[model samples]
Structure formats: structure tokens, C-alpha cells
Target: MEGGGGGGQELSTDNVKGIVLALLSSGFIGASFIIKKKGLRRAAVASGIRAGVGGYSYLLEPLWWVGMITMIVGEVANFVAYAFAPAVLVTPLGALSIIVSAGTFYPE
Candidate 1:
């Protein structure tokens, strides 16, 4: 059976870039999870802010603001990193953040 194309097989750089962006986004999401968790912990201890654990806005609690900002910045960096590097490589490197977060955040 003939495929649908001049021949039917040509790699698109855009597809690769999209995949890279997706992976990069994933790493940022993981990092965001850690950061937001830590931030919520902070906010809870802060003395003047309230926190709840239901719904979408729960992730944006005042204690979690620092985390939100950090995650935003990290995501921007991840995109830039992915634009220049392969997802396979970038994702592994981003995994390091998990260790870092566990050590720093989980302890508190």
C-alpha cells in the first residue's frame, strides 16, 4: 500500500521542536509541583495567610506565590534549554531538581 506523500517519509523539525517543548514543559511541571508544595508549607507557617486544598486556585495560595514565580521562571528557562537541547538530555538534567527539592523542601 502506498502512503500519502511524494514518498511518505520526511521528518519535520517543527515536530521535533514541539516534542522538545512538551518534554521541557513536563520537567517544569514536575519542578512546579515541588515548588508549590514547599511554598504552601511556607505560607502555612507564615502567620497571616490562609490555605485550602480544594480547587484550581488552591495552587496559587499566598504562601505558594514564591513557588509560582520560581516555577514560571524555571519553565521559561526549560523552554530555552529545550530549544537548544534534546528532550532526552534535558529531562534527565531536570530530574536533578527533584533531588534538590527533596533535600531542601521535604526536610522542612
Candidate 2:
């Protein structure tokens, strides 16, 4: 907790915590999607199946499962962030994940 010697609120400790948590949530979820996509691509190449074409081969992929678990953890952080801040703040921050995902893309 940070203290303001002057008698005015500079951002309470909860809000600061919420902001950090929200950012972490967005980053994790964004990176997770990219990872999941890569995993699916690898699985498809190995199994002669494409998830986009309704293939379930990703279910057998450990990388895909890792991405899934990462996504779940990110979602948990997002939910916890909501507990410390208003949705007005958290919802807009959620868009950072889209930015993160876009940055993570490659033309491969």
C-alpha cells in the first residue's frame, strides 16, 4: 500500500492491484490464444487433421492443453480483478488482450 502524506487519495491500493491484475490477465490470455493456435497447427500437421475443418486432433496435443490451462488461469485473474475494480475500468482494459494477440502474430 502506498501512502499519500497530503490528505488526498492518489489511487487506493485496491485499484492499483486491480489494474495490475487486469493487465496480467490480458497479456496471459492474448499469448495463450497464439500458443493454442500454434499447437493446433502442429497437431494438424502431425495427424493429417485441421481443427478449423472440424478436427479433434488437438485434444491429443499437450501444447494445446497447455494453452487451454493458460487461458483458464488468465480468466481466473480477470475474474479476480473484477472483485477489486469497477467493470468500467476492467472491461476497457480487456481490449489490451486483442492488442497483445495481434502483436503476437506472424506470417508463417
Candidate 3:
């Protein structure tokens, strides 16, 4: 669920395309997160420095920095994926972001 920057009843053609793109983008993003989480865990084990969370924030931890960088990289990767793949294939794949984000935020 991206591009919720505004409220509206109807989306313009461009908006429709953007929503489609964003959905596709999210899938790539979700996969990136999984890869990042594994890498973060490995690094923490190797370096003996674990990430911590507190005070409504994740704090200044290595995993936090890695997550931030992964977000940026994932956005870039999604653009690349869209460039190569058709929107139909990409949209559903990209939607993994919504499910992943929802699970993280509203865990079972």
C-alpha cells in the first residue's frame, strides 16, 4: 500500500498506473527485506552487536541503518524490475510488500 499521500474518489490515468507500479514495486521490496533480515542477523552474530528497540523507535542500531539502506535499494530495484517486466506480472509480485508490511505491523 503505497502512494497514500492524498485522498480521492477517482484516480486519474497516471494515478492508476502509479498505483499499479507501486504494487509491483512492493513485491521486490518484500523480498529485499527478507534478504536484509538474514544479512542483519548474520552480521550481528559475527560482530557480536545486536539491534535493539525502545521508545517508539528502533534506535541507532546497525540493523536500523541496514533497513534504511535496504528501503532505498529496494525502491531502485523495483524501478529496474518494472523496466524489464510487464506490469501484469510485476503488479501481483510487487504486492508482497503490503502483506509483508501488514504482517510486521499487525503480527499474529
Candidate 4:
């Protein structure tokens, strides 16, 4: 419905931007979890301590920090997206994160 006279459902640019941001958030946040885990694995191997065992070696890993930063950016993007679009449209998008994160986090 491209008609301008009355009721025509159209996606505003803000909604589109919000959708994009939400998708990016899912991707970044999803990948960050795996990346951080990968970093922790490397740190544990190199430093002789697993993060799960109270080891802080992951803190020294640049890759882990990168994952942290990516997570933060994803969260920020998710927050900002709310300002551009309704929660109804934004909230369900989080489900995408599970799909995006699940496969990668347990990579074979």
C-alpha cells in the first residue's frame, strides 16, 4: 500500500535502521560469546589455569578483551535500537541471537 491518502502500512526508515541494528547486535553478541570462550581456552592452555577454575589469565588475552568489547557494543546497539523502534519489533529479535550463538559456541 504505497497510497498516501489514508492507511497504508509502510516501514519507516527508523524501523529499518532498528532492524539492522538488532541483527548486528545478534551477530556481534553471538560471536562474542564463542570468541571469548576460544580466548579463555587459549589462555588456559598457555597459562596453566582455566578461567572456570578462578583463573584470570583470560584477562590478559587481547582476543578475550575484543570479545568483551564486542559484547558491550552489541548491548549498546540493542539499547539504541529501542529508541528507533518499538519493543514489540525489537524484543523478539533477540531469539535470533540464540540461533546465531548456539551453533558457533559449540563448534566442532
- What is candidate 2's lDDT per residue for 4-104, written digit by digit as tens? 56778566788888888899999989989988998998899998979989899999999999989989988999999999988887888989999999987
Residue 18, candidate 3: alpha-carbon lDDT: 56
Say which candidate scores most in lDDT: 2
lDDT of each: 0.62, 0.89, 0.59, 0.86
Q: Of the pair 2 and 3, which is ahead by TM-score?
A: 2
Q: What clash count does candidate 1 reach? A: 0
Q: For every candidate structure, what is the RMSD over all alpha carbons to the true structure, in angstroms?
A: 8.5, 3.8, 11.6, 2.7
Angstrom error of the Cα, residue 40, model 3: value is 15
**8: Cα error in model 4, Å:** 6.3
What TM value does model 4 have? 0.88
lDDT of 2: 0.89
lDDT of 2 at 70: 85
Clashes in candidate 3: how many? 2
Off by over 4 Å in 4: 1-8, 105-108
Which segments of model 3 are wrong by more than 4 Å? 1-28, 31-59, 104-108
Which residue pairs in candidate 1 collide? none
